[model samples]
Target: MTTASGGWTVIQHRYDGSVGFYRNLSEYTDGFGNVGTEFWLGLSYIKEIADKGNTTIRMEVSAADGSSAYEEWPEFRLGDAPTYTLHVGGRGIGTAGDSVRYFEQGNNGSDFTATGSYCGDIQHGAWWHNSYCTYINLNGEYATPGTRSRYDNGWGGMVYFSFKDKSSLKMSTIMIRRND
Candidate 1:
């Protein structure tokens, strides 16, 4: 792995799409021969509804950045719907209007950062309800149906929700590409 001067480390290896960890990149294992530290495509989990029109997928991760923390979740796959508990914690935690945005991946492995909208506080579980879902906009803003929602409490940053109840709807169909 080569670290860029800006701090983004680029890891080079084959990603078999199995299960493993990477530095500053998505977790993946290219094959069995290359173990940890080598470039390998570990696993790629994806969910899609066969007979549905709107494809909305919700993924549960370690709440940490980079691929290493992502590998912490066992049996990870794409499209497999799972309920999650949302919390906020980070350097960008508290401040008026600051928040963490959630986004779905595109076909190319890019974050599509511009498309992400703010869902809740980036620091931890600050803005959320037991059974509430919010929509996002291109500017990373959280909103209800039509109007704009405000994160007034600078102390709370914002609110976010997760799969608190197991009985909720099936999140999405996951397609596990590879498992190392």
Candidate 2:
């Protein structure tokens, strides 16, 4: 779903443990002849609702498989607001060597900056690996990923958001399009 402003495409997912969703960009063959998506945008939100002691929300991404390229953003308690916004985009879509960026903000007056520049890997499948946000739970243990699972595979040219925890989360908006 998309917000009224049409700036962002909203997505909501409740997490019982480690979970993720992704949007594929394109298809390409890796240097080793492994065929997979050339570029992908994976968004994962980690939070424990019941445990107020754990007040950190982590957002992470997996891109350029086998290149050890990844991005993560963590936000602390901003306020009591339950809504959050994640803005992701790049200069060009389907363009080789284009850079991708991510930003986030919470209703509690918390803001997160975009991570460093990351380019899609054409040689290796830019698949979503086991990338997750940092979870800091003081009272309970956080979830973790055991293997690589494509939650939203074949969803290219789109945006996806996954939420994992006891509480239900809502996405107000999601914007995916050309920046210029």
Candidate 3:
């Protein structure tokens, strides 16, 4: 929340393995962990605040090698319950490519998938996911910079392939602010 734009609210943030991201459906809906550390600010709450007004989302990630990247969207908001579907407007610009909103066959809305299933299990966490996952995954198992596997199955950790093809990121944070 220390940006020049100011009034930024952290929706999710992870730096260390202090908090687990591989949580169940209820846990994701209700949320868990301490915001001061690693945490997901919950589902319903996210929808409530986002729907209140026009919002912009910023996703920042850092690699083990000290490299970092980010992608921002001019508009962002989640859908109603049962599935907090993600709706990312369009890509702004940043070092990291715009992968949040897949506008081809994938459309733009993606339902928030519960962890421990499909790509969530293989990728290690949950979020608004598409059939082809891994565009961006901040809510994944935390791992040290170099203490992880380089295989596909071993990719159950933080991933932002656009960031130098790094499957296991060192740090990541997602924050939102009302554009109004």
Could you arrange the candidates by TM-score from highest to lowest?
A: 3, 2, 1
Put down candidate 2 lDDT per residue, 69-171, tens digits, no spaces. Answer: 1122222322221322222222212211113321222112322111120211211112222122212111111123222222222111111222222211221
**Candidate topping TM-score:** 3
Q: Score candidate 3 by TM-score against the native.
A: 0.88
- lDDT by residue (31-112, candidate 3, tens digit) is 8889888888899888788898998877888888788887777678888887887887766667686554342125257788
TM-score of 2: 0.21
Query: lDDT of each prediction vs. the true structure?
Result: 0.21, 0.21, 0.74
| lDDT at residue 16 of model 1 (Cα atoms) | 28
Clashes of each: 51, 10, 0
Question: What are the runs in model 3 whose C-alpha is more than 4 Å off?
Answer: 99-107, 146-154
The weakest ten consecutive residues by lDDT in model 2 span 26-35
* lDDT winner, 2 or 3: 3
Which scores higher on lDDT, 1 or 3?
Answer: 3
Name the top lDDT candidate: 3
